[model samples]
Target chain A: MTKFANILVPVDFGAPSRRGLELAVDLARRNGARLTLLHVFDVPVSYAGMGLSPTELLAPMWDAEQEELDRVLAKVRDEIPEVSRETARGVPWREILAFIEQRRPDLVVMGTHGRHGVPRALLGSVAEKIVRLSPCPVLTVRAEDEA
Target chain B: MKRILAAVDLTSTAHLIIRHAVELARSMGGRVRLLHSVVIAPQVPPPGVFVPLTSFRAHELADAARTAMESLEESIPRELRDGVVVEIGHAADCVCEAARAYDADVVVIGAHDYGLISRALGTTAARIVNRMDRPVFVVRPMPTSHVVEPEPVSAKAG
Candidate 1:
C-alpha cells in the first residue's frame, strides 16, 4: 500500500477549511504523514495603483493576518503535534501551486464551498482552481452536503 | 462504515486509484465498489465516406468495457473487491450515477493534469467533485522514486 508521507492542508479559517483540516489530521495520523498547514495572504493589486506603496499599505493587514494564522496554527498544533505551518503572500491559487511544486506533498486536502449554477460560474472557487492545477492530488471536502 | 466507490479510467493510474480506495476501506472498516465508464464517442462518418449500416457501436463498446471492468475486478484481491460496475455514457455522469445508485460514502477518483486545452475543458474528476454531493478523493500518481524511498527528514522538517 502506498502511504502518504506528507499531507498539505490549506486553511482559510472558514468552516469548510476547518472540515478539511480535520480530515487531513485524520489521514495524517493514520498514515504517519507530516501535516503542513498553509495560509496565503493575497494583497489586492489595486493598492499598487494607489499612491501608497503596496507593501507599506499591506503591512498592517499582513501583521493581523499573521497573528490570526499563528493562533490557528497553535490550535492545530495542539491536535497534531510537530505539524509544520507556512504563510505566503501572493495570489491564493498561484502561491498554493508554487508551494505544491516546491514541497511535492503526496496529497493536498482542502475545502470547497460546493457552489454551482450562475454564482459559481461568476465567482470561480480557489479550491476548484487548485484542484485543476495543483501538482499533486487534492481531496476536496465540501462545507455542506456531507454524505 | 464507509462505502467507497472508486471511479477509474483504466489508465496506468487505475491501479493506484483502486489501491487508495482499498486502503481507505480497510482502514475505515468499509467496502469498496469499482466503477468504470465507457465514453462512447459520437460515431461521425466522414463527410464523403460510404458507411455500412451496422449494429450500434455504442452497445459493442459497452460490452467490451464490461469485459475489461470484469478483468480489472479479477485483478483486485478477492477480499478487497466487493463490487464492479461498468456503465456507458459520460464519465462524470456515470460516476455520479453510480455513487447515488450504490449509496457510496465517498467517491475516489484519479486525476491527470492534462494540457491547457483539456484543462480549459475540465477533467472528469473535476466534474465529479462539482456534481457529486459525497466527498471526492482525487489521487494523482506520485513518481515512483518518491514513493519507493522516503525523503530526508530535514527536507520535510523545513
Candidate 2:
C-alpha cells in the first residue's frame, strides 16, 4: 500500500481545474496529505518585444496574481485549511514539471480540458505534458462529458 | 466508490498498478477489476498471397492474453479482487467500455516512459485520459530509490 504525504494541484481556475481542486481536497483529507495549490503565470510573447523590461512590466501583474490566488485560496481554505499556495512565472508545463522535481510530491492532481485531434496538436495540453513527463503519479480529472 | 478498474498490460509494472488500485479501494471501501486488452494487429497479406494469417495470429494473441489475465486475477488480493476482464480491442477504448460496464468510480493505469516516439504519438495513458469520462489515475513506475532535492526556481519577472 502506497501512502501519499504530499499532493500537488495546479489550477488555471477553469471549471475542470476547479473540479480537480475538489478531488484534491477530498484526497488530501482521506490520506492526510499536504496539499499545495500552484498557479503558473505565462508571460505573453508580445510582452517580450514591448521594449520595456519584462520584469518591470510583470511586477504589478505578479502582485495582482498573488492577490487573485489568495482570493481563490480563501474559498477553499474552509474545506482544506492547511493547504499551501505557490506562484510561478514560466511556460505552464515546464514550471509544473520543475515544481514536481523540486517538491517531489507523491501525486499530482490536475485537470484536462479533453481537447482532441488537430487543436490538441496545435495547442499542446499542459496536463498531457505533465502526465507524460512528471516523475510522480498524475491523476487527471476532465470536465464532465456532454455526450 | 464501489469499483475500480485497473487497466494493465501484463508488464512488470502491472503488479504495482494493481497494488495502487487495490490499496485505494481498500481505503475507500471499493473493489478492483483488473482489465487487460489484447491489441490484434491487422494482418495484410500481399496481393497474390492468400494466406490465412490474420485470424490465426489474432486467435493466438488473444489466447495468450487470456492466460496472462487469468494468472493476474489469481494474484490479486482476495478481498479487493472483484473480477478480471480480458478484452480484444484498442487499449483505451477497452478501458473506457469496461469502466462503463463495471460502473467503476475511477480508472487506474500504469504508464511506461516510451521516450520520444511515445511523446509524439501519445501513450496509452494519454489516450485513455482524453477518451474516458471517468477520472484516470496514471501511476508511473517507481524509481529504485527515493531522492528528493529542491530544483532551482526559474521565475523571471523582469
Candidate 3:
C-alpha cells in the first residue's frame, strides 16, 4: 500500500471543519501516519493602524488559539497517538502553503465551503487556494449538503 | 472509505489520478468506480427554430468517451476498478451525479495546474468540491521525471 505518511488537516473551528478532522483521524489511524492539526491565526493587518502593536494584540489571543488547537487535536489523540498541533500567524492559505513547504506532508485533508461557502466569512476560499497550489494531494470535505 | 468515485480525463495524467484512487482504496479498504465526463456543448436552438441533430453531439461524445475510458482501463489497476461510467455533460456536474449514483464515500478527481482564469472561474474539481454532497480527493498533475512518449491528442473527456 502506498503510504500517506504525514497528513495535515487545517481547522477553523467550523462545523464542516469538524468533519474534516474526523476523516483525517480515520486516515491517520488506518495508515499509522503522523497527523498535524493546524490553526492559523494572525491579528488582522487592519488592526495595525489602530495604534496597537501586533504583539500586544496577539498576546492574549495566542494562548486562546493554542488552546483551541489543542482541544481540536485532543479529540483525535486516542485514535492517533502521534498527532501534533500547529498554529501559524499569517494569512490562512499563505501560512498553510509555507507549512507545506517546510514539512511536505504527503496528504492534506481540510474542510472546504466549496463554491457557496467560498464567500462566507472568515476563511474565504482558503480550501480553494490550498487545492490549487498545494504540491501534494488535498482531500476537501464539505459539511453534509442540506439538499 | 468503502467506495470511491474517481473522475479522470483522457490525458495521460489520468493514469496518475487512477493510481491515487487505487492507493486510497488500498490504504482504507474501498473499491473504486471510474468515470469520464465527456465535454459536449449544449445545443439549445432559439425557441422558434427547430434544431436538427440536437442530441447527436451528445451521443457521439458519449461513445467516444466510452472508448477513451476503455483505453484508460488497460493502463489502470483492473481489480480495484469495479465499474466504469461514461457521462455526457459538464465535468463537474457529471461527477457529482455519478457520486450520488454510486453512493461513493469520496470523489477522487484530477486537478490541473492553475490557469489565470481558474481562480475566478473555478476548476471542475473545485466546482464539484463545493456543490458535491461528499468528500473530494483532488490530485494535481505532476511533471514526470522520466521522459515517456506523450499521449496522443486525447478525446475531449474529463
**Each model: TM-score of chain B?**
0.79, 0.79, 0.76
* DockQ-based CAPRI category assigned to the predicted complex of candidate 3: acceptable
User: For model 2 chain B, where is the 10-residue window of minimal lDDT?
Assistant: B149-158
Task: Give fnat for candidates 1, 2 and onward, in order.
Answer: 0.42, 0.55, 0.64
Residue pairs with colliding backbones in model 1 are none
- What overall lDDT, based on C-alpha atoms, would model 2 receive against the true structure? 0.77
Model 2 CAPRI rating: acceptable
| CA-lDDT, candidates in order | 0.75, 0.77, 0.76
CAPRI quality of model 1: acceptable
What is candidate 2's lDDT per residue for B64-89, written digit by digit as tens?
88788777766666766787788888
TM-score per model over all chains: 0.81, 0.82, 0.82
> What's the true lDDT of residue A146 in model 2?
19
Supply the DockQ value of model 1: 0.35
Candidate 2 Cα errors over 4 Å, as ranges: A53-57, A116-124, A145-147, B45-64, B114-122, B146-158
Q: Across residues A1-147, which tens digit of lDDT does each residue of candidate 2 receive?
A: 236678899987777788789888888877767889999998877888779976789988877888888988888787777789998889999999899989989889987776554333411378878888887878888765411
Query: Which model scores highest in DockQ?
Result: 3
How good is model 3 by TM-score? 0.82
Query: DockQ of each model against the real complex?
Result: 0.35, 0.36, 0.45
